[model samples]
Target: MSVQRRKYDPDFKRNAVRLTEDPDRSVQEVATNLGISKDLLYKWRRELRLKEGLAFPGHGKEALTEQEKRIKELEKKLKDAEMERDILKKAVAIFSKAPK
Candidate 1:
């Protein structure tokens, strides 16, 4: 039997990270109260700090920074251009063929 992992939403993660921000509350204390491991809380805090607005994009979704987003857009454009070029090449080849 496999133990299923629990999933927490972005809001819950943000709230947990926020609670650790309190001056009076220790990370261990907060984690204990929340029934989570301190390491997990620390990891969340690190992601929140590093990713900021892009953190916690949830399951099956990517969290891309501004630079990453731009790169993804450019890559998509390149793929489309390459596909069009291939199609045009095939068309030209077919049209250039002499009738039997």
Candidate 2:
């Protein structure tokens, strides 16, 4: 049997992370009140701190900055070019062989 993963909206995640930021509330307390795991709340808070407010892009959502998007595009183009070059090399090797 397989277990299905639960999906939370970006707003919910952000709010949960925000709750963990409260000075008066312990992370465990907030997590219990929110009905989410303490570890998950900590992880979200860590990510939010690291990203400086940009966190939790929901599934299939694009949250990359302009530079990050450009880098991803370039990386993909480079991968495609490398694949084409490899195919061309293989084709050249095959055509250069002698047949009986």
Candidate 3:
């Protein structure tokens, strides 16, 4: 059994992909500057794009972390307070219109 070894400098690949993200730079130019195959550069670029917006490979984490959870709770309380104020205003208006 033989384990095939593939030699690749990931730093160059990462830099090439990062520079390629700039609309002003050409992929061919970045690939050449990074001294890697344009094909590999494109593959890395595609991988980075695909990886975006995903928190992890599997089992997405909660959108609200602990601090965010507290913030969301506070926001809910504020919204409820505003709604209660509106209700109180309507109640006062109704009472003021009633006869003595």
lDDT of 2 by residue, 4-99 (tens): 877878789889887777899999999999888999888877877877645778675757888999999999999999999999999999999999
Q: Write the per-residue lDDT of candidate 1 for residues 17-66, one digit (tens) a residue.
A: 99999999999999999989999999999999998998899985989877
Question: Candidate 1: what lDDT?
Answer: 0.95
- Shift of residue 50 alpha carbon in model 1, Å: 0.9
User: By the lDDT metric, which is better: model 1 or model 3?
Assistant: 1
Model 3: runs farther than 4 Å from truth?
1-6, 9-11, 53-100
Give the alpha-carbon lDDT of every model: 0.95, 0.85, 0.72
Writing each residue's lDDT as its tens digit, candidate 3 over 16-52 gives 6779889998899987886667897777778657654
Q: Compute the lDDT of residue 21 as modeled in candidate 2.
A: 77
Report the Cα RMSD per candidate. Answer: 3.2, 2.5, 11.8
Could you estimate the TM-score for every candidate?
0.70, 0.76, 0.40
